[model samples]
Target chain A: GAGVSQSPRYKVAKRGQDVALRCDPISGHVSLFWYQQALGQGPEFLTYFQNEAQLDKSGLPSDRFFAERPEGSVSTLKIQRTQQEDSAVYLCASTVGLQETQYFGPGTRLLVL
Target chain B: EDKVVQSPLSLVVHEGDTVTLNCSYEVTNFRSLLWYKQEKKAPTFLFMLTSSGIEKKSGRLSSILDKKELFSILNITATQTGDSAIYLCAVERRTSGTYKYIFGTGTRLKVLA
Candidate 1:
């Protein structure tokens, strides 16, 4: 229960609609990450944040995908004009330091039709 | 580009059997390698290895890293039914003064009673 938590474990959205997935990392975690896992595949990096500053987002597939961690505690991943290819499990992880073990949330499963 | 590769995509074993999972990576600015076990939801951290030749063990699960060879292995002895899940391997790399993970597709294990 003290681990990372994610909202809307499952979401179904029609194509061209927008969707937002939220992640609440463990208390005091300084590093946050977002990843997308396609069916039967390992998670691919999406973005990274330290405290409230987003440091890397090269993994984002396109400009339509956006993520923010305004206060450094919680993060939100938004996808505009969702497409069928966007259906996957979005996972969030956090750690105390760069080299520390990452703690992962349950992940938000999105299905775009 | 950073990449992680896992071998033997799927395995089926019976109780009391021993299994080994392999992960190989090629990345820039390597930081650490991590192992996680995923069931139906979140992936729980199992081990994090930074230095080579040091084996990290917990219960019947153990992992070792070889930075020189750019690979790692996870071994589980006397496997049980509860061990049925996906084992993921991720490599952390420092980029843009931050860090991100490159994950392997994962090895799916099924243990029968």
Candidate 2:
């Protein structure tokens, strides 16, 4: 079985630019999560979705961050007006249910100059 | 705010040696504790502990949780170079009918061959 997968393993953007990171969760997974990991730090939750419904977005740092899962399988995290502080790895994870074991993706590393 | 802490932010151990990583957390409506192993890219799930006093083992790695104390310990016996990575601890809690995960700073283990 394939695990979670992310696209554009690496990305470089200038300040004030917008960037979008994509994630494809495992098939049949009902829960999806996004996290941001800074250098030498563990991942911090960004948002969560359950079958196309955005359940939680409180972890999102600011209003510039937006995420959506339209079809209940693939998700995208979009950051508007990128900032140097946003330079981190964006990780995606999926699980069978709430509080279940989560499988993570390779992550997309974003660099804002 | 919910918080998770890991001891000995970094450690170095020689092959064949045994090591223990600690994780303690404080959160509202605690649900479960999870461990993950991260190398360069993705963080892979190691174990999920929902009960106290029960130990979960796989190969040379084992983990136990102490719910009453709000902590967990992961033990790696006969460590190998392959065990070199960052070990992350996360706690899950329910908030507003949704679950969120709080992660620790992580313990960086460098296993020398």
Candidate 3:
């Protein structure tokens, strides 16, 4: 089975620009999560969705970070006015249900110059 | 604030040697603990533990959780060069109707031949 997949394995953007990272979870996965990972560090939670509903956004660093999962399938993480601080790997994960084992994607590495 | 911490941020071991990585977490509504092995891209799931005193084993890798102490340990016996990677620990907590994960800084293991 295909695990979670993310697009644009690498991205370079100028400061103040907007960037969108895409994620395709496994078929029929009901839970999706986004995380940010800095170099030499573990991933930090960014947001979570159950089906098409955004269940947890508290982990989002700021208002600039937004995510949505429409039709209970694909998801997108959009960062508005990108900053150097946002230069990190954005990871996506999916699970079959609540509290289940999460399968992670390769992640999209974003660099803001 | 919820947090996960790993010990010995980095380690170097020779092949055929055994090593142990530690993870400790503090969070509200504790649920489960997970271990992941990351190479260059995606992190591969190793184990998910929800009970204490029970050990999960796979090949040369094994992990045990201690809920009462809010910590877990991952052991890799007869390590190989392929075992060299960052080992991450995550804790899941349920809030409201959703679940969130808190990850540790990770322990980097470099196995030498």
Candidate 4:
């Protein structure tokens, strides 16, 4: 892909439901990141991956938030038992390598009703 | 705790008017500052500043970082309606051999025609 891409541009889930969002980074990118953005707020770091290795998971907010990059190219972010507070935009980004500028995807807006 | 802050949560300007956005950060091991323009869900890269006092520019958009002050400013000259969007600032920090970005709550710029 020319740029990072994410699946389910929008999602509406009932409280307590689980939702999974997908991201396809640019070809051969070595680093990927996940973030959550609430209304009128900046994107908050969630997790990071260097290749297939999950080097950092410090930012995941809670046990319900999970992310994985099995192949180092595509990643998935899953939220368990979604809550109304979880309504926000989930963004994915990738960089050619560590310390490089990131390219963002067209975030998935999850609305927990 | 690493944190980023942006000023002027929202701005209203007329076309052809100039605007400046501010970003400040307090973090350990700061590496660089980046600016992004987000019109929808996706935020596109604009500029990256690594050296203090050196301005990085592209056409009507320019940004400068001041490490001593721990802040950066993005200036847009002769703005257009198309330039109306959220401007985000992020700081890259390296810690424990891992890297992450801390973003500020972005400035919402509205250029009226």
Off by over 4 Å in 1: none
> Candidate 4's residue-wise lDDT over A77-113, tens digit each?
9999999999999999999997788999999999999
Model 4 regions lying over 4 Å from their true place? none
lDDT of 2 by residue, A4-112 (tens): 9998899999999999999999999999999999999999999999999999998899999999999999999999999999999999999999778999999999999
- Candidate 2, after superposition: displacement of residue B65 in Å? 0.7
Q: For candidate 1, write residues B5-38 as lDDT tens digits.
A: 9989999999999999999999999999999999
Scored by lDDT, model 4 comes in at 0.94
Q: Comparing to the true complex, what docking class would candidate 4 get? A: high
**Model 1, range A4-74, lDDT digits (tens) per residue?**
99998999999999999999999999999999999999999999999999999989999999999999999
Candidate 1, residue B73: CA error in Å?
0.8
Candidates 3 and 4, the one with greater lDDT: 3
TM-score of chain A of 1: 0.98
- Per-model TM-score, in order, reads 0.97, 0.98, 0.99, 0.98
Better of 2 and 3 by DockQ: 3
Question: How do all the candidates rank in terms of DockQ, highest first?
Answer: 4, 3, 1, 2
In CAPRI terms, model 3 is classed as: high
After superposition, which runs of candidate 3 have C-alpha atoms over 4 Å from their true positions? none
lDDT by residue for model 4 (B1-113), tens: 88899989999999999999999999899999999999999989999999999999899999999999999999999999999999999999998878999999999999999
Candidate 3 per-residue lDDT, tens place, B16-103, comes to 9999999999989999999999998788899999999999999999999999999999999999999999999999999777889999
